[model samples]
Target: MVGALAVLAVVLILWQILPGALNVPRYVIPPLSEVLVALTDPVAFPRYVQNAAATMTEVGLGLLIGVVLGLALAITLTQLPRVYGIVFPYIVAIESIPKVAIAPLFVIWFGFGLPSKVVVVVLLAFFPVLVNTIHGLRNVDRDLINLFRVNGASRMQIQVRLMIPAAMPQIFSGLELAVANAMIGAIVAEFVGAQQGLGVLILQAQGRMETPAVFALLIILSALGIFLNLFVRLARKWIITWERT
Candidate 1:
């Protein structure tokens, strides 16, 4: 932690001094001090809160819905190989399309609303969770599965008691990736069309040439991503306590 803080301190120092030392225009890259000031600017702070709230809502909704859908689909695929063979290719094809490229289409379909942003986030998050969960479920120990069968465990009992627990680690990894993707999806969708969000704030700052504000917003986003990643880590520890063994 100390080393990380030291590195961050050095970066901040450089950010504060480099533009002046190298004669870079403030409009191009404002000093870190200026960006900090923008972060605390009383007039803009409320707006920041409002926009951030919108983005957070989209992220939360999308993450919950995406994870649930992914888990359901993974379980279905695992239990029904024929269905998996039929639909997995279609899923891959949809996931193959660039999410950014589809943002505008989502806006057209969902109409510049929060629903569009949430849908984009769902798309971004769904595949990772599905793939990871499926991988974990499919790779369970055959010996253990046979043992369960020999002991007269029902298929549902084996799945609930063994498979899902075993899959938690991979599922958590997917959740971490999904968190980042969800953030990106929300921002990208907002950029395409939204009345409010950090993305909209960024577009506004860019339009007004408020470079410091833009940098500040980016910093806010990075911090949010970090918080979410940490949250997932904590949740993983709680849910997968046996992992420590």
Candidate 2:
């Protein structure tokens, strides 16, 4: 995979350079050399890291909140039949609303700060977790549940010993997706209104028509995405420690 990436990098470098070396208009595209040239400078690089950190901080907090609330809601909806009848529809309705459409309201209400970005991230990230967790819990192996009952386990014991453990993998599956969504949502929230962050830097670069800087921000953001994915994969692997069996 590393070799493949290196090959692709070489190809892209060649692809980007071939045109500009022949004097392709700058308006058409900047060369890979130009992109690399810009990348060499340290001044523009740290801002990308700072902004990425800001966005990641918001995403981490929001994903944590979203996962907790989603799990709580999913368990409630599954365990109590009566609660589902009253609450599930509301959950659907709230989840159906466009997060971006209401993100400005979050900013207006929570102010243009981390709180608002975190709120947006949670709103966008929770649905996947909620739906997946509910599905996982409600679709437990009937035999295992029955075995627990036959053993005279109470509801809490059934939940703790059987249901939650069984559902954990699926829950983490949703959580992985939610983490990515949370990051995207945080960046988008910042793009709409933020004083610092990659999204803000992108907006600034866009306003200035700084193509190399824009590309630089994009590269850094992509790296952040890769790291987030790797971390989540590691977390999921740890959470499902029984999967090896």
Candidate 3:
């Protein structure tokens, strides 16, 4: 962890110095010090941080919905072969549509607000969860399934006791990747519509040539994304260890 922080510190220190050394305009790309100021300054921070909060809210809600729906769908696919056959093509179709193209329609249906952003995040987040979860569950041992049957476990019992536990490691790994994608979807959704958020703030900043603010907003989003992934990873590690012998 110290090594990683050292690398990040070196990168940021270079970022702080490099642009000014190159004599670049703040309009095109601001120096890291200026961007840091925009991020740390009270007035700009509150205004800019709202977008990050908005996107975070959307991501949280969207991730909840995505995990539930993905797990349910994975359960169906792993156990109900007929339903899986029927639904696989549609899942692919839904995932194939470009999110940017779909964002406007989401706005039209759900309005230019949090709901629309959640929809986009869920769409972007679900595929990873579904694919990984289905893969994990299907890869379960046939001997284990027979063991559950010999013990007279019901279908639900077998699924709840066996499949979910066995699949957790893969599911957690997929979820970490999904969290990053969800953040991206939330940000992109905000960019397409809505009055407040980092997306709108970024648009306004770009219009006014406030490149420092844009970079600051991006930094905040990246920080939030890292926080989420790291938290989940630590939680997953503990859970995996606890479940093992």
Candidate 4:
């Protein structure tokens, strides 16, 4: 924590002084103080908060859908190797396409509303969770599987009592990746077009040459990402406490 504080202090000092020290134009990189002022302005701050909340809603909804679908598909594939062989190649092909390219299609299909952004988030967040889940389930010890079989454990029992518990660490890792991807997906979808979101605010600020406000929005986004990442880490620690022992 001390190290983090020290780094943050250095970054703030640099942010405060660098633009003026380097004679950088305000249009390019506004001073940190100006951005801070903009961020704290009662009117501006509330707008920022509203837009951020909108984006976060999309992210959260998308992540929940993505995680549930990914876990369900992963389990199905693991249980049915023939189905896995048939489906995995298609999944790889689809994932190979840049998701941003598909965002426009979603916008067209869902309109310029929350649904489009949520869909984009789902697309972005799904792959990591699916891939990690498959890896975790497939990597279980053969000896453990045989032992369970010899002890007359059913396949469902093995899955519930052995595979899922063993896969928690990897699943949590995937969830961490999904959280970050979900944020990106939300912002990117908003960029394509949105009624209200941080991305829209950013575009409006850029158009009006409100460089400091734009910087302030970016700072808020970064802080949000950091907070979410830390939350996921704490949740993982709590959920998989057995790993420590």
Candidate 5:
């Protein structure tokens, strides 16, 4: 925490000094003080809070749906090798398509509302979890499986007692990736079409040439992404304590 604070302080000092030192225009890069003022402005702060809440709601819901679906599909594939062989290629094909290209299709299907944003988040977040879970499960120690078989352990028992626990670290790694993707997906959906969200606020600020407000919004978004990533790291430590042991 102290290290993070020190880095933040240095960045803030640089942000406050660089533009003026370089004789840059305020319209291009507002000073940190101007951005802080925009961030704390009474008229704008409340709206920012509301839009942040909306974006977070979409991110949370989409993360839940995507992670659940990905885990389920991964487990199914692992349990059925024939199905895995048949479906893996198609999964690769689907993932090859750029999510930005598909965002419009979701907007047309779900409209300019929370649903569309959630769908985009799901699409972006799902692949990481699916890929990681499959990799982890497939790479489980064969000796462990043989030992379980020697004990006459059922397939379900082997999975629950050994495989899942061993795969948790990789799954958590996927979760970290999902966290960033979820935020990006929400913002992209908002950019495509939305009445409220940080993305929309950014567009509005840019249209009005509110450079300070734009910088303020970017700061808020960066802070949010950092917070979410830190939360995931904490959760990973809790869930995989054996790693530290």
Candidate 6:
């Protein structure tokens, strides 16, 4: 932690000084101090908070729905291999489309509102979990499965007591990827169309050529992404304790 802090300090120092030293244009890349001042502006700070909250709401709702749907579909496919074989190709084809390219379509369908942003996030977040869960469920130990069968364990019982638990690592891996994708989706959707969000705020700042404000908003986004990824890691540690042992 101390080492990380030191590295951050060095980066901040460089950010504060390098522009002036290199005779770089402030409009192109503002100094760190300017960005900090922008963030701490009394009038703008409140607006930033409100917009960030709106974006977070979209991310949280979309993530919950996506994860639940991914898990359900994965479980269903695992239990019915024939269905998986039939639909897997179609699923892959859908996943192949660029999510950013579809953000405009979502806005057209759902309007320039919260629903569009949430739909984009769900599209970006679900596939990783579905793929990882399917891989984990199908790759379980044959011996362990037979042992459960010999003990007369019902299919549902084995799924709950064995398959899901065994799949936790893979699920968590997917979740980490999903969190980052969720952030991207929210921003992209907001970029395409939204009443309020960090992405919208960034666009406004860019339009006015508020270089410091744009840099400040980008910093906030980077910090948010790191915090979310860290949260996922902590949750993985807590839930997958057996993996560590």
Per-residue lDDT over 1-245 for candidate 3, one digit per residue giving the tens place of the 0 to 100 score: 99999998999888878878988777877778888888898877777666677777899999999888988889888888988889888878876777657888899999987899999889878888898898889888999999999999999999999999989988887798789888888878887888777778888888888888889888887788889999998889888886553
Give one digit per residue, the lDDT tens place, for model 1 in 62-122.
Answer: 9999999999999989999999999888978877888767889999999988999999999
Question: In model 1, which range of ten residues has the least summed lDDT?
Answer: 92-101
Give the residue spans of candidate 2 off by over 4 A: 2-7, 18-24, 242-245
TM-score of each: 0.97, 0.90, 0.92, 0.96, 0.95, 0.97
Clashing pairs in 4: none
RMSD of each: 1.2, 2.3, 2.1, 1.3, 1.5, 1.2
lDDT of each: 0.93, 0.83, 0.85, 0.92, 0.93, 0.93
Q: Give the per-residue lDDT digits (tens) of candidate 2, residues 1-245.
A: 99999999998978687876788775345677676666666887776777778988888899889888888888878999998889888878887776778888888899888899989888878888998898899889999999999999999999898998899888888888887788789888998798888899889988987777777777788888888889888987887888874
RMSD of 3: 2.1
The per-residue C-alpha lDDT of model 6 at residue 11 equals 96
What would the TM-score be for candidate 5 when compared with the true structure?
0.95
Model 4, C-alpha of 219: deviation from truth (Å): 1.2
Q: How close to the true structure is residue 211 of candidate 1, measured as C-alpha lDDT?
A: 99
Q: How good is model 4 by TM-score?
A: 0.96
* Count of clashing residue pairs in every prediction: 0, 0, 2, 0, 0, 0
lDDT of 1 at 154: 96
The C-alpha stretches of model 6 lying farther than 4 A from their native spots are none
**Measured by TM-score, how close is model 6 to the native structure?**
0.97
lDDT of 5 by residue, 53-147 (tens): 99999999999999999999998899999999999999899878877678988999999999999999998889989989999999999999999
Tens digit of per-residue lDDT, candidate 6, span 96-193: 88867899998999999999999989888998889889989998899999999999999999999999999999999889988999999999899998
lDDT of 4 by residue, 97-157 (tens): 8886788889999999999999999998898899899989999999999999999999899
Worst 10 residues of 4 by lDDT: 94-103
